[model samples]
Target: MSTVTVVNRLEIRFADLKKAGRGALVTYTMAGDPDHETALAIMKGLPAAGADVIELGMPFSDPMADGPAIQLAAQRSLAAGGSLSRTLDTLRAFRETDHSTPVVLMGYYNPIYARGVDRFAAEAAAAGADGLIIVDLPPEEAPELTEHLNAHGIHLIFLTAPTTDARRLPAVLAQAGGFLYYVSITGITGTASADEAAVKDAVAALRKSTDLPIAVGFGIKTPAQAAAFARIGDAAVVGSAVVQTLADSLDEVRAATEKTVPAVLGFVATLAEGVRAARR
Candidate 1:
């Protein structure tokens, strides 16, 4: 078998951010939202708009952990013919113009399982994806997929929630790569707000266990909220609010309008400013 050596852009990005003395701004968007062309435009524009890392959400019919905004985004994407292959294509296209920005594929596991772990891993690696955030795939049950991704030098990023106590944390951190995503809230994504004090305590506790970068996500809506969480963690991830911006810009039929791409990118720029200035 031929071995492929990966550059590990995620790790390099984190190290660079650390040197700059600021937190990274991570943005999430559904691939093929409204339409493939508009979604690609937004993806291409993200890095210039100040996003440090891009989390390209893979559309799934049953995104249980996601709230209404993301669920609606997935619905719109699926209607526009979004699939695993198409999502990879989007990443590949984004890589054509911009290569340094780290991109993580975030979503559920069913689609990856349907495509087979090895094939999915190979395709993702070839497409310039830096990491993965499979929400439904717990570490205990992820060995098979993890193995395939490891062989390709792709990081299988894991999520830790507010309830991830001392006992459960070791298991979560053992196989985790790239970064540890800390779900600031307990329930589904974007429904409630993330308590700053609770998240500060949680991130402090997490630092005792692992040296991996912690990215705070879920319930972070505005620039101030992103700035607060970014100060607590190494990075800040914003999803539902970003998705909602895209959704709102769509036409009455849920189709992409002239405002779709610009609106999403503009909002991300504001959040990026918050994250960039957080530690300074």
Candidate 2:
């Protein structure tokens, strides 16, 4: 049996959101995207910009599930010396000022495997990360990492897709912690727009099987879309849109150092407003 762990920032944030009667605005940005310092600046500014939860992308050489925008972001991050160690350092730095906002490391599992699951989980918890969202690690093969993370009081968040049928949901939910990220689309991330009615129905159905918070991601771009999804789920995750925003505002040097933080934060503020006003 899975042991119930102590409340981390993720659970606290969701509890607070429930009290406020508003959904969360979860922001995703690649750590060290463009560069480490610049990405760290964006991370530090997220909370003040109204981000309830932050999903920091750990740069990987091959981000199979991502679209061109995110793939490019990873390439930029890698070029700028982004690695698993540096990603943890970035989180440690972000924890210096913001202790309440939850930070979830989102990526694949190879990095963790290379670092050793036990060592990775301990370091991640110590670095002040609240949870993890490993895209490629399904529930069946997750016990190796999940055991360590659970022991360290870190939530191992799981992703459910549009194709995840009824038979598989229970197994997925059984190992899921923090929240369930429902990929609102079938294909790669950011390739298409989310279908609202489909998302609403999915959330309603998932609620029947588990009480975990549901955060919809994939194809969510604008404040209007975030607001619509927020009304239906516990949170709305916007990734590709934010990555594209940074991409659009980059300087001639291909670095968003001068304008990325402010630009992305401003966009996040707008998203937060929409989420706060959802169902109101």
Candidate 3:
């Protein structure tokens, strides 16, 4: 039997999302990907589209784990003057208007390291960030980072893969707060295929070790794919697709975001329904 352990702030919210049998649809967008105003607008629109949680991408110069698409998005965001401080401010702005949903800050470690770890945690927590996902930082070097984040009640969500053997998984799960972000496929951000079977197998493998809510991500692009994952995992995380939808600049980007937001939300709603249906 899997033992459910509650270790961080995000676990509380994530647990609630799961008890309801509804997987969350978390989308990642680079803060000021193209420009700040539009990024803010995209953040505002996400909740209405069925997003239970939002993962704001903190643009950095080098996103080692990220693939071409997201790397390019980061470049665009930086070129347009996105910064770590500004991203937190953007989150704070959204919180001023609506504070119901949870938010997580997803980014590379360089920017955080540049800003100083302790200060970054304090600012992120103050800005209503519930979790942190630093892709490049491995568990060994995360003690300092995790300690500071936990002190402020922020979940340090960690990523694990199929190759992360039994010995490593336990350690990963131990330090892993929030939900475990199970990378469905290996590589960069936006590759696609509704490979539910593969993702399902991965989730099953992960379930054998820990009861932490698992959110399957990395190329989930359709409602059908979301529904399929919602059946196996507690929730699903979507990226690339949303960012790609808003990739263009100016009028084209705005139009695409407007269209993409509702469509993705509808997909999440459908997946949530699938979760509800699963219990009965």
Candidate 4:
């Protein structure tokens, strides 16, 4: 496929959701959390469970931006032999059956850096990754990775926050594509709730800066919060909460139980309901 076609998948998804009169429900999960097979199962069921986009986490030892739930999830996945290659393989498998739902690889920069940016970009593109959210990479230092990603038709999704000032906002949006991720809270993921009024104003300001669909993440835990964010932003991303659900469903030995996949998908369904109900 052409690079344009590969890259436009994200734009196409958001456009479809906009026409449907609702925000996209972007669900996040660690690639091999609990175990490889179970994680793949949960990923495959996400679209039917009401996810418009899937943020497949690339597990790292030090996920400084995430909270306890996601940190533990990364640990579990790594312990089960989760690696960048394995994560890409899982995506390739998922693509065998589904092609439409956009998948963004979300993680820190260490793994990608070690894997070689150009090679990683090529592999990610071939594996059906539509975008990437490298939490630690700033726009200034992103040229090397951004160049390769752009060549492969992958979006370098950048994160903006409540702390992003007028001067800093321009740089963040400079090379951002697919969608802009808005970190609702200043701290870390899954800690504290987002203030609705603040988010509304923040998104409004972002809209004036760029037309890229803004996805609000961090601090979104429940269906109510998802619905609230859906009304304000182009997409609502729920990560740590979903990870926590999966963790809760795991067996005593930290292996996947019968309820693992279903529990996560069921929670996603409820959140999707809230998001879909927003504009209706």
Cα lDDT listed for each candidate: 0.93, 0.92, 0.76, 0.94
lDDT of 3: 0.76
What is the C-alpha lDDT profile of model 2 across 235-268, one tens digit per residue?
9999999888888889876777567888888999
Candidate 4 ranges beyond 4 A from true positions: 1-7
- Kindly list the per-residue Cα lDDT of model 4 for residues 190-274, writing each as its tens digit: 9999999999999999999999999999989999999999889999999999999999998889999999999999999999999
Q: Estimate, for each residue in 162-243, the C-alpha lDDT of model 3 and write its tens digit.
A: 6787888878888987789988887778875547777888889898888788888887766667667766787777778666
In what order do the candidates fall by TM-score, top score first? 1, 4, 2, 3
Off by over 4 Å in 1: none
Q: Could you tell me how far off, in angstroms, the CA of residue 1 lies in candidate 2 after the best superposition? A: 19
TM-score of 3: 0.87
Residue 43 of model 3, lDDT score: 86
Say which prediction, candidate 1 or candidate 3, comes out ahead on TM-score: 1
lDDT of 1 at 181: 97
Candidate 2, position 272, lDDT? 88
Q: Is candidate 1 or 2 superior in lDDT? A: 1
Tens-digit lDDT track of model 1 for 1-280: 7876679999999999999998889999999998899999999999999999999999999999999999999999999999989999999999999889999999999999999899999899999999999999998998989999999888999999988789989999989999999999999988899999999999999999999999999979999999999889999899999999999998999999999989999999999988887884
* Model 2, runs deviating above 4 Å: 1-6
